[model samples]
Every structure is written in structure tokens, then in C-alpha cells.
Target chain A: MKYVDEFRDPVLAKSLIKQINILVEQIDFAKERPIQLMEFCGGHTHTIFRYGIEQLLPKCIELVHGPGCPVCVLPMGRVDDCVSLAERPEVIFTTFGDAMRVPGSKKSLLQAKADGADVRMVYSPLDALQLAHKYKDREVIFFALGFETTMPSTALTVLQAEADGLENFSLFCNHITTVPTIKAILDSPGMQLDGFVAPGHVSMVVGEQPFHFVCEKYKKPIVITGFEPLDILQSIWLLIKQIAEKRCIVENQYARVVQPDGNFPGLDAISRVFELREFFEWRGLGSIDHSGVRMKDDYARFDAERKFPVPNVRIADPKSCQCGEVLKGVIKPWQCKVFGSQCTPETPMGALMVSSEGACAAYYNFGNLPELMALKAEREKEEALS
Target chain B: MTASVPGMRKRSGVLRAETINMSHGGGGKAMRDLIEDVFIGAFDNNELSMLEDQARIELSTLTALGDRLALTTDSYVVDPIFFNGGDIGKLAVCGTVNDLAVGGAVPLYLTCGMIIEEGLSVADLRIIVASMKAAADAAGVKIVTGDTKVVDRGAADKVFINTAGVGVISKAHKISAHNAKPGDVVLINGYIGDHGAAIVGARGDLAIENDIQSDCQPLNKLIQSLLQACPNVHCMRDATRGGVGSVLNEFAVSSGVCFKLRETSIPVRTEVRGMCEILGLDPLYLANEGKVVVVLPKADAEAALAAMKSNQYGVNSAIIGEVTDAPTDTVILQTSFGGERIVDMLVGDQLPRIC
Candidate 1:
């Protein structure tokens, strides 16, 4: 608790909040209109939503969610591959719980599980190793997912499986790097990003180098922040300062755990097992070149994609869902038509509603259905007034 | 030549290779026979032999306090065997003891049962046992009895712990979900989701390095201090399996009142929030090992907050919400945008294998 508790000083947080409020009020009233800031990390977006940080800010400032969630950006074709692997009899599909509910082709991993595919929810890639050892007769394929923060673990699992001489396990690697995704977001048409709240966990592994592209090329202020309320608040305060001064650079607010170099051991393992794919299809972003990692040639024998026969299922997002615009910071969770009505955490229509890091899901969980609530409230008021 | 008795027929060389298989949880003669032959044999105690789903215990007549006590039982199943903050052993004991403590009980004794998988290193087992001993000693509670069983290697994970604790409750300590009243203030001990995040980070799965450790500890002393400082405390509940939201829902239903929470008031660690966001999880629904949700009368709310802050475990404690009169038997959240939302009970599993 020594290193952990110090970051959450209530007294310091209060003073900082006071300073931020005063600063917000003092900004040029007529010179600048709404100061639009985009937080590129899904984690920061959720913190901003969960802690109600946006509601605390002045009306002159508008915060937008960026294309940061790896799962939301993942395309339908890759999910089809995982679903096909789940259909195989000799395989046991292991994945994070969020991926289980994400719709693939005609069904999801959860649907596949219900249909008698040996699907399991694992907390880590190590648990996948345990499953492989337990079911030695069958194949255990991990549906590897996530950004730089989770890729190293899948890489380690592969290396450890090879070292242990376990042939029944494989990785269906969908590991994507962070830098390219950020570039894709910024380069996209009509991209309006003033600054970014860089992901803390990803920065811990990639360590501020990959994000340099955003600073040098785009001139967008980027603040790598931790996931706490104070961390997000502090990062926002930093971002606002940078924007006000017309300076753009990568600043690290989470210095305690994340170093400039990052943890070398994890990176070494990742470099050993994975190689960058030239072009990979992201669900919303189409195909971003050099955006994702696939199993290296040496590990192909353990790769489920090679072992299993899966049709290259090219699918499109539901015509109504504006996930692309949502991910790119052009729209908010409340702006989505499927936010609380047709698409919810219980019955998700897209990956955005399924993952906990998904902006739509977080907003729904914390109650962003103001229109519905207001309607009910007005009815009650009218009944009393009459 | 030495003559061997039937009981001594199996020697070190003749011992069967140990492995955990699924039959251990099958609820058949294989489980019972294994329990009696291996587990009971190793443990060898009278309390375990009673063989009831519920434990029945008697207080020491020497310090008989004339009042009935509170009882709580908890089960722990964390993966990777160990973590950065603490291991399964420490979590098992602290979890159960904290439950009884927040229920306004003076934790006195505990009973533990271990379901250990075959092929687990004996050295690892020893470390866990030592951790349990240390945590119990720190809490001033005795592990009077315990049970141990080794299953086939595939049958169980490394180890799973189930601990039930008994504590003496004073008559003055009138606290339960049913006791919450309108105008009562809701408070949390500190930040939520630290234990869940630490366990996840310890797995080395996310590739993110977090200095975050599990906030797993005993809160009996803290609860006792709060009780003494403010006897008018209406309700108390530990934020455990379903986090703060679940506990608040329980209070609302039991007290037949509505509840409202402030979005800006809740405390959460940045590292945890980051992990939760990346993983698509909600801190409101994530588990906490040492956090609690309490409702107290407005008159004693300040006193209760001061008392909680006096303890090391409750340093970041703050009044987050209050009991309300609308939507009886439901819990609502007051969004920072001046909107109202329902904070419902946990449906199914949120985060599993996270103790």
C-alpha cells in the first residue's frame, strides 16, 4: 500500500481540482470556442465516464472517446476464424470472458460453448497452459486478444509451452500493437484530436516510443496516465496545460510503475514469439497495415489458424451501429442508436457493447440513458402537477 | 527380514504418484473415501469429524459475554497459486474474518478446509500455511481446526480454500442490511478493485507492470473502532464478491428503501481503473477483498467517518451516498450530470477466480 496509497491523496486532489476549476474559468472566453480533447485510450475514456470527470469540467471543454479499445477495433473476419476454431471437436477454446460474448458470424464463443464446444474463460494465458496439460489428449487453443499490454503474456505462454514440450497447445494470436492503431486513428478522414490520454498499461510495455509518432507527426499533446480518477484528472490537467501553451509531446504522469525502457523481460518474450503482419483487418477501421502480430514460423505448428480450416468470412458491421464514428471520437456512447435499447451489456449487438473497456458498455453500466430517465421523471412530475 | 503390518504396507517407494483428477468433486464414495483416508488422516481433529455442511461451535465459558454472535463463511479460489500482494492463504482467512468484523462481530475462531491438487510442490503448501498462520496471528484469531484433501492433479487447480469464522457480537452492535433507514449516509472504507487488479497483474497476462498489490487484510479492529465511536450506525456490509453495488442493493431490499450514490464520491485506484477499462470491466462490479459499504445515521455520520479514518485500513474512507425514500426496495445512483440511475445487483459472474 506504500506506493499505491500515496497517489490517492485526497487533500492534494482537492487542491488540484480547485486549481483546474479556476484555470478553466480563466481561459480566454471569446478567443477559443469549445476546446475539444480526445482521450485515445479506452481505459481513460472509461475512467472519465465512471468518475464523472466530464460532468465536472466546464461547458467550454468537450472530451471525446478515441479509437483505443483493441476489441472494438477488431474486424469480423478474425472473429470468424476464432469461431471456426471453437467449432472443431479436438480443440478447447480459451479466451477472456469479454470475447466470449462478442458476436462472430452466426454465433459467439458463448453460443459455441452452449453448442458443446469446449470453450473456457481463462484469466491469463498461464491458465491456458494448465488446460493444455490437463487435457493432453486434445488441443487447447487460446483465442489471444488485446493490445500491447496483453500481447506479452500470450508470447510468454507460447515460449513456455515450447520449453515445456507441450504439443497440444496453440495460440490464435490476434495481438495488435498500439502505435499503428493510434496512427490509423489520427490519419483517418476528418480526425479532430487536440490531445490524447495514452493508455497506462500499454505505455508500460511499449514505453513512450511508439507514441512519439503522435507527438512528432501530428503535434497532438499526449499524456500517459494511470487508471485512477486522480490519474485521469491529473492527466487531463496536464493535457489542458499543453494545449493552452501550444506544445505537443509525450508526458508520463504514471512514473512509479512505467519506466522509459519498460520491462525488458516481457518485451523479449514478445519479440521471440510474434512478428508483425503487414495488413490485418480491424472490425471498425478496415485493414491497418503493420497493426497486428501473428505467430512466427517456428510457432506455426502450434498455431490454430494453420491447424484448423476456417473460411475467410468477410462481414460488415450492422448498418445502424455507428461504432466506427464512436471509436474515432466523432460520436459519443449516448450518440449510438444501439446504446441502451437494442444493444446492451446483456444482449450486445457489437464488440463495443460486449467488452468492459468498451465505451458503450461503460456508459450503459453507469447509466447514460438520460432521455429515458427524463421521460419517466416528466411523467411523474405531470402526474403530481395535475 | 522385517514383518510389515497392513497399515504400513505402503512405503516411500511404493507410494502412488500423486495427481489431481475430476472424480474428487464428483460427490461419490471416491470423494468421501478420499476425504476420510487422506484429508482427515492428515488433519486428525474432532471438529472436522462432525461432518456437517454447517459448523457448530461452542464459546469458551471463561469469557462468556451473555450475547449471541455473528458468523460468516467464505471460499477463495485464485489462480497462479500466488500474487504480488498476498496468496490464497492470506486471502481466505482475511476474507472470512473481515466479513464477520463488518457484521459487527469480534472475530474469535476460524475453521479452514483445503482442496489441494496433486503434484503441487510441498514447499508452496508450506508457504501458504505460514501465510495463514501469520494473518490469523495478526487478526488475533485462532485457526482452531482445519481440513486438507489432495485431489488428482487435473481435478483441482493448485489449491482452493474455504474458511468459516465465528465471532462474538455485543448487544449494542445493532447492524444489518435491514437496519438501514432513510437519510442514512453511505460510506466506503477506501478504493475498490485493488485486490482484483493485483491478482490479474500477478498473472503476468496483461504485460502491464502494476505496483498494485491486493488490498487483502483483516478489518475487525477497524469495524470495532467504528462501532464504539458511533453506535447509531444503521447498516454494514463488506464489498466482496460483487463489489459495492451488490452490497448496496442488498441493503436497499432489506431495508425496503431506495439508495443513491454520488459518481464523484467513489474512490478507485488508477492502475485498477486502467486494467478494468482495457479488459472491459466495471469497478462498481469488480470484487474487493478489504473494502466495505456502511450506512449510518446523519447525526453520527461525521463521527463514523472520523472513526474509520483513524484506522490504517480506512484512511481514504468517504461518505459516497445516502438512503432515499423513492423507489423502495431498489438502489439508484445520482450521476454527476444531475441524472438518476439504478445500481442493480450482480447478475451471474463478474470476474471469476478473483478472490
Candidate 2:
């Protein structure tokens, strides 16, 4: 709490807000009409929702949810394959909790588990290696999921497994790069992003350089922010200032944790274990080239997909679930028909409801805008009046 | 003494369970067998007579609460050590208190044991310890005692925290999952699944920043408030490892009552929903550290909400669902669009080491 409390100093936050307000007043930010700020980190998106940061902004400023959710973007076909692998009698599929609920061709790993398949949930990829060591006769397949932030651990686990000669273990790699997903969002016709709140955690791995492409090519100012209320507020203020000044540059606000080049050994681990895939199908983004990482040819034997015969299956998103639009910043979470009515967390209709980083979940949990709170109050008043 | 039915034992190593075994939770003969064979025989505690249901203790305190309180301890072995919103320290304190808070007691004190890996930096240890102290302070509890053990570099992760808490509960505050009654309104402290997502994001190797931090805080204050405001509060549960869905199912099984939750009423963050989608995780099944589910009589529901909202930790509290008579022992979710579906208990550890 020592390092944490200092960053969230309400007094400093006020001063920073005052500075941002003064800067904005000087540039007449209101005249910009609509300043669209897209946060590339799922964390930033959640922070914005959690604190009602978007509602606190001026009318001209709008924070858009970008392609920050990795789980929501996972292609249905790949999920089906994971489920297929999980269903195999000899194969014990180990995955993070998120991967288990993703629907694939009418089935999920949870369903497979309910049907008596050997599907297990683990905290980390290393846990899968531990499982492999525990069950030598059984083939342990780690459903390697997440972005650069989580990929390093999986890579380390793989390198360790191979070095230790744990032949029964393998990884079903679905690690996607952040920059490509950002590009995909920027390229999309519906994307009206003016700037980006770059991911802090991912930047801790790939470094601030990877996001340079977004700034240089897309001409958008990117602010890498820590995952805290004040960090997000400061980042938003920075983005607003950049939009007002018509400036485009990549910035790092989370300087304490994220280094410009990132951790060399962590990057080395990822580079050694994974090879860029030419093309991978994202759940909503379609096939984006070089967006994902697969096990290198040398490590194919430890690739769960290669080690086992998996049934290729593809499933459509629930017809009413507008997760694609939600992810692309085309619409807000509440805009979806299934937002709260049909797709609550208890009975999620789509991947957005399943993943914790999904924008919809963020809104449902923390996006209690003043208007909604007021509405609830009004409802109570009306009840009394009646 | 014929060794109390020769408790359950593993054929191999003490830590390692041979096969995907079920000896861990064995009942009756198997349960005693496991305790004697693996636990009692190895770590021979004087108090662990291996009572089938619980470990009993007698205390000499004279108060409104019972003389004897059920005290338990556990260590969080979550991976990635530090998470988006919090670290293992906060989780350790809160998780320990939740065990007591949910048991209808005012968590009074705690003891923390830190297992630090050799190479772990002093900075990280300080952060975790600071978080533990902050969590304990927030819960209005103290770290009465602690121990620090440094293992070799590979022996443990950066850190693991084991915590034991002591609580005092009166007969009036005696809440449990089995106390849920038909026609009780089920309420949650706030949103669900933030802690799990925050931890996942903290891995820092993931591209997306799940800026959400761990909702790891003690709910004893909130529970005490609720007990004061509405004594009809029949049940209380911290929606931890199994999330809301599984917790509801557990209540249903224990109380022999059905639960029906509204889709529109349950709170979740849009970002969390999006991340869950991308990651293919169910926010319902994901863990929540600072959240609690309470079952109160319909008449006292509003009062309970008022009490919860007044507390700092329960600002966004909501009545997510209600206990029902239908189905008797099953949990059902009413979809936002008016469809009904079954909500089952989690079968396996969805996110293990999630604390």
C-alpha cells in the first residue's frame, strides 16, 4: 500500500486535474467537437468504467473500448479445438479459468468437464507442467491463453518443461500480440479512435516501442498507464491535452514499472519458445496476419494441437450478442441488445460476458454512471409517490 | 489406540496425490483414513482428533459470542504473485477474515506466515507486507503474530502467505450457507469477478491491461453493519473461488432451497465482460475477493441494502437475486430477456490459486 497509496493521492489527483483543466481551457478542447480516445489495454477500459471516468469528462471527450479483450477475440474454431482436445480420454486439458467457459461449436470446456472429460483449471502455465509431472501417463495439454503479459510465463513453462524432459506436457498456444490487434481496430471501418490509452502490463513486456507503429502510422497519441484510478484519470487528461494540441506521440505514464525496452530475459523467453503465426482467426476480427504466436517447428512435439488430433469446429456468436461492435469501439456496452437483459454474467450469451477483461463485464460491474444511480433513486422516489 | 480408523494416506510423496485422487475430501472411514495416513501421522497435531465434521476448540473467554470459535487457516498459492489490483498479501488477510466473517463472527485478529523465495526482492516483500497491514487495518483486525520463512529460489514462488484469523460471534450473528431460507433476498456487496481478472492481468505478459485491481478487502465491517440493521440475515457467504454462480449453488445445496437471480440486476464491469469474452472465462464463475452474498428475509432486504451502502466497501451493493421454493435445491438464473437457465456449482478449480 506504500507504493500504491502515493500514486492515488487525492490531493495530487486534484492538482493534476486542475492542470489538465487549465491546459484544456487554453486550447479550447470543446471546439474539437468529438475527441475519441481508444484505450488499447483492457485494464484501462475497466478502470475507466470502474471509476465512472468517462462520465466525469466533458461532452467533447469520449473514451472508446478498443480491441483490448484477448479472450473475446479468440476465434470460435480454436476454442472448439481446445474442447475437442479436452474431450480426449488420454488427454488432460489444463487451462486458465477463462478458457474453460468460452463456447465452441455448442460446447465448452466446462461442459466437457461436466460430461466427465479430464479438463482441469490452473492458475499458470507452470501449474500445467506440475500437472504433467504429477500424471506421467496422461498427456497434459496447457491451453496457453492471453497476450504478451501472460505469454512470457507460458514460454518459461515450456522451456522449463523441455529442459526437464517432461515429454507428457504440451501447450496449446493462443498468445496474441497487442500491436496487431490495435492496428486491426484502427483499420476497421467502424473504429473512430482519435487516440489510445496504451496497455501498461503489456508494455512491461514488449516495451513502449511496439506501440510506436500506432503513433507513427495512425497518428494517434498513446499513453501507457498503470492500472489504478488516478493513473487512468491522468492518462485521460494527457490524451485530452494531446487531442486539443493536435499532437501525436507515444508516452509512458506508468514509468515506475514499465521500462522502455521491457524485461530482456522475459522477451528472450518468449522469442525462444514462440514463432509468429502468419495468420490467426480472431473471434470477431477475422484472420489478422501475424497477430498470434504458435509453438516453433522445433517444439511441435510439445504443441498440444500437433500432439493430439483435435476436431476442428466453428461456432457463431449468439445472434443477439453484439460483442464484435462492443470490442471495436463501434458501440458502448449498453448498446448491445443482450447487454444486461439476455447476457448477464450468470448466463453469458457471448464471450464478452465470459471474460473478466471484456468491456461488457466492466460496465456491468463498475459502470454505475450517475444517471443510472439517479434513475435508481428516482425509481425509489416514484415508488414512494405511488 | 487403534489409530482412529487409519486416516487417508497417499502411496507416494506427502504433497503429491497419486492419480487425480478423491482422498482429499473423503468422508467417514476414508476421511479418517486420509487424516491419519497423510496429515496426522506426518504433522501430528494434538488438537486434530480428526473429528469427521470440524476441528473443535474450547476457549476461556466470557462474552456475548460463544466461548468456542471455529478457527481455520490456509495459504494462497496463486501464480503470478502480484496481480492487477492487489498482491497475495491483501488476498491472504481478506481470505482469512472471510472464512470467519461468513461464519457469523466479528473477525478480531489474524496471524500471517510468509513463505518468501530466496531471490524475491526486498521491495516486493515490503509491498506485500504493507498490503497485508493495510488489509488488516481496514478489517479492524491486527496481525497478532507472524513468521517468515525463506526457502531456496526454486522452493517457492516470489511469496506465499498463510493466514489464520480469530473471530467472536454471538448467537444472533450466527450466519452460514445452511441458514438460507425460502423467500430470502440474495444480495451481493458489489460487482463480481474483478479480483480474478485483476490477478490475471497482473501477469503483465498479457497484451491487454486489465487495469482492474483485486477487490481484496475484509467484509467484517459490512457484515457487522448488516447484522445490526437486519438480524433476519439468515446467511452470508464471500463469493470467492467459485464466484456467484457456484456460491449460489452451494447455498441451495446446504439450505435445500432454490435460488433465482436476475440477469439485469447483477453488476459487472464492461471491461471485465469484454475481457471475459476475449479470454473465454465466465465472470459468474470467476473469483471475487471483496464481494459477499447475503440472504435476508424479504422484509429486511431494504434495511440490509441501506446498511451495506452506508459502508465504504459496500457502496455499489445490490440485490442480485432471491431464495425460492421451486426446484427445492437448485439454483436458476433468469436471463435478462426472461428466459430461465440452470446455474450449477463449479466442478473443478476454474482459476486455481485465485485465493
Cα displacement (Å) at residue A284, model 1: 3.3
lDDT score, candidate 1, position B237: 79
Candidate 2 structure, TM-score to reference: 0.58
Q: Report the lDDT tens digits of candidate 2 across residue range B1-355.
A: 5575455332322323332123333334433443444333432333443433333445554255655465769789888777776778878988999888877787876766666666566456556667776787778776655545656667787778798888887766657788888779999988899988887787754456868877888888888888889877788888888899888888898999989888779998877777775664678888899999889899998998999999998999999988888566677665442234556565445432110
lDDT, candidate 1, at B314: 96
lDDT of each: 0.77, 0.74
**Which stretches of candidate 1 lie above 4 Å from their native place?**
A25-32, A261-268, A367-386, B1-181, B184-244, B250-258, B261-321, B325-344, B352-355
C-alpha RMSD over true interface residues, each candidate: 6.8, 13.1
- Residue runs of model 2 more than 4 Å from their true location after superposition: A26-32, A371-386, B1-355
Q: For model 2, how does the per-residue alpha-carbon lDDT over A136-198 read when each residue is reduced to its tens digit?
A: 999999888778998889889988998999899998888888877788888888567778888
Candidate 1 lDDT, A1-386, residue by residue in tens: 35534555556666767666666655574147666777767777666665556665666777777667776766777777888888889988998776777777688778888999889888788999999999999999998888888888888888889989999999888888788888888889987677788888888987877788788989989988897778877887888787777789999998976888877888898888889999888776678989888888989987888877878777988888887778777777767766666887777776677665677776666544344456447666978999
